[model samples]
Target: MYVATKGGERAIEAAHQWLAEERRGDRDVPELSIAQIREQMSLAVNRVMAEGSLYDPDLAALAIKQARGDLIEAIFLIRAYRTTLPRFGASLPVETGEMAITRRVSATFKDVPGGQVLGPTFDYTHRLLDFKLAAEGTTPEAQRKSADETPAPHILDLLDRDGLMEPLETSEDTPSDLTREPLEMPADRPLRLQALARGDEGFVLSLAYSTQRGYGRTHAFVGELRIGTCAVEMEIPELGFAVEIGEVELSECETVNQFTGSKTEPAQFTRGYGLVFGQNERKSISMSLVDRALRWEELGEDNTGAPAQDAEFVLYHCDNIQATGFLEHIKLPHYVDFQSELELIRRLRREAGAEEREAAE
Candidate 1:
């Protein structure tokens, strides 16, 4: 039970005031505009949107500014604001297969149907930090290319033609929203994917690394990784057909895992898929690895007692907001609780001393 502390309201208010001032440090420096953060620190904004489960870049930038660049705190702010917003109808699933070609690569194949396009990647860049960026007014230009009219075919589709990859089962059932419903154990693929989509990047990456290290290993190969913008569409109630809403940038990773033939099923390559908001290749790849690890039961693979293989452990702990709330709460006012524990210990000592005195007498 938590007891309300007396005469601390003023102190709390003062602390909050000081925090606000600290958030705006050095008044002499030029203030950071929302646009600046939205354009320049785009990766941070993307991460905030992904983990916060909100897509508004303006709001994310504002939250980041308010939180003094603390991404986790910014996510908390966005999530809190998200709860107050009215629910709109869900958009139809965006088709990644039709994504405008930006950065597309295949690890399994030398040359895919559409040639590999290396779009705005740091894959070949040196690790050295360029000090020139520190100076103001640096305008960099990238080579332009004509937009391809044709939609790049998915690598998985190519494998499917050969009957080498496992066929995906289509479902007309509406997937449950993890945001709306309490996470129940033994979650389905859709629900688990939802959680992982918004899960902590570091946590997911670490779990994925564990799998690669022989813990619940799936011998996964990156079938394809694509980063591009896809059109989002929503169905109107009055109009029976879906209309284009807007476009959102996404990074998608598809992993081809080795699967030996089971008695009931023929030998074929299984898949793990990850699609996330923005061009976050690391998170997307990590998400795919963890997603595959969690499929041990359904894939007829043995559970290697790995944390990633345990759905309950992964789902319960993946949420950064929930994890931080519990962790940060320890620093709160526990004076009353601590005093109670102190009194109990004192009473127990007193009783033991009394017993000892009586025996001596």
Candidate 2:
């Protein structure tokens, strides 16, 4: 049985070999190149990168191919690979504010400073399956627009000028890296938001959906959702000035949620925030809602015992890697405990037999 297996190492290797053979069903057929995977199976790569918290498309593609198109498996590969790579130094926090925005939209505002650009999204597309993609050969579009050089403005800043929503000031303190560190309870706004962004999409979605269903309802509106590449810079000890290392794609979402305040405190609107590695709007949006819902305690509101309001609950359950690993590991050997139970049952039966003979005597 899969649960009684002892040689996990051998089983893993054999499974991988079989998977590799299955991945290339016909030996005569040409193999999939990393570039092809990167270009064609880009969505899978995107999800891996978003959840894995790594932005290397080539690595993501290879992981996807190696995992036989398993997205979560690809994520696990990325995470495992990331664990071994030596940490060269911390990069400066990417300035999303200064991000050369390809897409910027706000649901809470109309006629704002910089007009909303929908950019690349499937939101408007019909749910119909594209059978054309399954055709023998297809080259749909070569249309790709280069980004404009104009500076972009945030919609929330405009609202901040009007003094409607609570204005958040930028901080100079160094933020904690969730990947390198274990998450502590009672995390700050920034740390909590980071964890939720890279957290499991489905888990976050369910939690957010729960809030919307009146479990922890906070009237929510997508304040802004922006997607684009931002420069990652690092300060060189010798140079002192930071140098640009590279750029990574990101999806950042900010939500304006319902107001909560007492007579003593001013009625100020709260914010829910989500920021992810690659282009993942849904994950980011859901993260923001969950983030806001978790803020009940700090906002001086009574705990409604909502799933989202439970800090220990949301943070513990949000990660896909941890969740999947633990869940699937049940397939491995657990018979030591089972054997103990078996021995206990046998002893109980033997004791019952002896007691029966004594009673008869």
Which has the greatest lDDT? 1
The digit string of per-residue lDDT tens for model 2 on 1-361 reads: 1255579789899988887789888989889899999987776788899888888999999999888888888889999999988888988888887777777788987776667777877889998988877785666673656554456676777767777677684899988889999999888878887788778888999999999998885679999999888999999999979999999888899999867576665777778888887778888889989988988877788788899988888888888889899999988667787788888999999999999999999
Question: What would the per-residue lDDT of candidate 1 be over residues 1-361, giving only the tens digit for each residue?
Answer: 4667776989889999999999888999988999999999999999999888888999999999999999999999999998899987999989888888678888999888988888878889998988887786667776867545468889988889999998996899999988778899889999999999999999999999998998885689899999888899999999999999898888999999988867788889989889888878899999999998998888778888999999999999999999999999999888888988999999999999999999999
Show how many residue pairs clash in every candidate, following the order shown: 0, 0
Quantify all predictions' global Cα lDDT against the true fold: 0.90, 0.83
* Prediction 1 global C-alpha lDDT: 0.90
Instruction: State candidate 1's TM-score.
Output: 0.94
Clashing pairs in 1: none
- Score candidate 2 by lDDT: 0.83
Predicted structure 2, TM vs. truth = 0.90
Q: Against the hidden reference, what TM-scores do the models get?
A: 0.94, 0.90
